[model samples]
Target: MRTKLATAVGAAALIVVGIGGAQQASAAPKAAPQAGLSGSKTWGNTVGWATCSGTGTFRVKAICKWEGDKHTSWVTLRGGSAKLVPPACRFKIERIGVHQSV
Candidate 1:
């Protein structure tokens, strides 16, 4: 009887842990600036693209590309490198119009 009780307890514990894990996995990650912020440039293609408000995981990954127009170059914003408290966010660039006007 003791052995049976122990087994049952273990099973119950497993079930609880499993349920918790599932809930965490299924829960939608809250995204910061949860809308088009017009400054969160994720990507671009010579002309137009999408922009985000900030950077962070929000049930989906952030991605954008842009061409600098005398201001930024090769601009991009991505998710955090670690589990960010507020989340490290920035715009990345890989070009230099240098007054060339991208």
Candidate 2:
């Protein structure tokens, strides 16, 4: 009876340690992707394309129509003919259209 109780206690302790270790392992640091020249990134917050997009260190009103999340995030941009412009190499933002890529 004593041996059985000790074994059970030991097993429970090991299980606890194993679970803790697993959690810590998953908390390891991860590398972030490279950002483009227009580095106005807001993760969950949506901003006007002018607010986010860039045009030679300035924001263009006509180009500002392209509004959405950062390139790191997934967005659905579709409407009329998609007119896109590459403000940055990583992603090609639309210049004129119903939806913008950036």
User: lDDT winner among the candidates?
Assistant: 1
Scored against the true structure, residue 31 in model 2 reaches a CA lDDT of 17
TM per model? Answer: 0.31, 0.31
- Stretches of candidate 1 above 4 Å error? 30-102
Q: Candidate 1: lDDT over CA atoms?
A: 0.36
Q: Which ten residues in a row have the lowest lDDT in candidate 1?
A: 93-102
lDDT of 2 by residue, 1-102 (tens): 999999999999999999998898466332111122132322112222322332222222222334431322222222222122223322333342112223
lDDT per residue for candidate 1 within 1-102, as digits (tens), equals 999999999999999998998897455333334442223323332222233333432222322235212222222335432221111224543322111101
The CA lDDT of each predicted structure is 0.36, 0.34
Per-residue lDDT for 54 in model 2? 27
Which pairs in model 2 have colliding backbones? Answer: none
Total clashes for model 1: 9
- Report the Cα RMSD per candidate: 15.6, 15.6
